[model samples]
Target: MKRYQFNEITTMQYIFLISGTQIGIGILSLPAQLADIANTDGWIAIVIGWIISIIASTIIIKTMEKHQQDTIFDLSRRYFGRTFGTFIHIAFVAYALLASITVVFTAIHITQVWILPNTPNYLIMMLFMLPGFFITKNGVRILGRYAEVVFYLTLWMPILIAVPLQKGTILHMLPMLKEGWAPIIQAVKTTVLSFLGFELAFVFYPFLKEKKHAVKAMVIANSISALTFLLITITCFIFFSPDETPLLIWPTLSLLKTIEFPFIERFEVIFLSFYLFVMSTTGIPYIFTTVFGISQLIGKKDHTIVLLVAVCIFIFTSFLYNPSFFHVQTLGSWWEKYGLWGAYFFPIGLFIYTSIARWFQRGKKK
Candidate 1:
């Protein structure tokens, strides 16, 4: 039950962890969701979404910088007062818990569909949650390092899928913006979900070794995530007809299945194994953050105890919404709207409050 010091993780590690967490299962469905809105101009939507994400992320980083020693919970209490801030913390914890549940269930659904049609869904949930719980049980620094390692698989899988450009038709993206700007802007809202994990920077800032470089890490993480997602969106749009893209549940996996390697008959089987690692990299941190925040709330500094509570919560919630696989998809779409609200708006509001409070304090000093 040792308490760890802040400033243990380097800026690069923070950037990589944030980018890795953001890029998870969202990438699989983004092309279809964006296409549903923007049609063939989904990539434009992704770009616009990235612009909004950048602005939001910048505000979050600046707010964290203003209160270098304090967590977001502390800042909220300072600005919003004790009662309101406690409510805000409860809201944050709820959002984090729901996000963890959504990801676990989504992973279970994906596994049931693509990998193990006959495997019991609960078993699949346990398989994914076990490693994540184990890692987070160690500490945040351990979790950050593990995320960096698994992130390589995240990069490699997409590159391997992208190698089949010969099968992709650049013409598929043609008649660009034929539907006009409104659809693209609408699509951007959906695509932006892929970049949601960058807000973790606010929570992780105190763990950064170079505090001044936190903002740089945040920007780099978002930029890399945006670029990776943009590539996926454009490549998928070009590779498959917009009509065909929506037909596939996991379009990225579908893309891998289409790829034929000289020695490999099924690229997807290999891809899924590595992709599971990437998915864990994305999911484990959300659970970790939730646990961390809860521990902070209850004044518990023991990582193992906090992690056990998180594991129990994940296990409990993972089953609470155990409808069939189709129901899981429906739940995901519904949960996504809340995801957007929690991940995007909550931090932005906090940033605004912190900024105004800082200005007032400075005015009083002057």
Candidate 2:
């Protein structure tokens, strides 16, 4: 797939793209998930994870700075040669596919439970899958545009959450660190899992319009996500007793239950319905990156065909397997382990390798 001038995304689109991806289905359960492990200290864990994400993102940008026009796939081929690079690309492609389809399945499961209990998983999958294809097929710029649009559309959501907070108690979060940092450290893994989507910087950095601003963009992206997650984490802790939190499956959704809306009966249903768009902002980038990586691997110009086929296969596969909440957690466990390697360790390792190799090349030239 050849890169086009239009494929480049502006700094704002760039910020929204990475941040938007980071804030997906995870937000619904993250506060409760963290509270289960660390009590009110879970929000602290999110801060730790956010700092870690920004550091890793900066490393990723520094790695790509050497070849500002090349993506992870291109870098692998440059430094590691064709065979190893192809293997590396294949590994990433598989990871992205797992993540993309897992996101789709998770979204379907959430929607089924909250809004459409009677709807078949396949029917719901189709509804989600179609938009994914159309959103990603146009390429990254469209993805940036989609992400930006979704970000603005959901900006008013804080107001929806504010009504419930009035009833919440600051007392619930007091006596912080009752169990000490041990529990907070245990919960870091959960927050890091929520922080998983920043790895797309591997794909996005090459297309960034202003390379000088990449670090700033990365900070803004992580800050936006960290703040959003932090706010929700604190709200849930304050709104629900720490003991009551882990009991509710989607505490953030339940947080809205306290809000008495004039026009709507179940506020969660309305919120979940609109969140379908938010879910797309999360999944579409993974889908786009998956197809793009595969196309570049095979030296194909037309990733649109690849995108269509992958989406259809995913929709088809959903009919065979319908995951419950426990099953979704099982899927999340797999992603968490894989994501640590794919999104975290891999970039740091790659950056070191490239820097050393570049140093040796400069020595030879000297």
Cα lDDT computed for each candidate against the true fold: 0.78, 0.88
* Candidate 1 C-alpha lDDT tens digits along 1-366: 112374277777888888888888898888877877777788887778788888878778888887676666676787888899888777777767667767777877787777788987667777887888788887778888887887764667667867766788998888988888988877777877778887777677777777788767778888888888888778888888988887776787777888886887877877887788877877887887788788878887775787886677666766665667677677677657777887788788777777788899999999
Best by TM-score: 2
TM-score of 2: 0.97
lDDT of 2 by residue, 302-333 (tens): 79988888878887788788887888888877
Candidate 2's displacement at residue 30, Å, is 1.0
lDDT of 2 at 132: 82
lDDT for 283 in candidate 1 is: 80
Give the runs in model 1 whose Cα sits over 4 Å from its true position.
1-7, 316-321
| Consecutive 10-residue window with the lowest summed lDDT within model 2 | 1-10
Steric overlap count per candidate: 0, 0
Estimate TM-scores for all models: 0.93, 0.97
Best by lDDT: 2
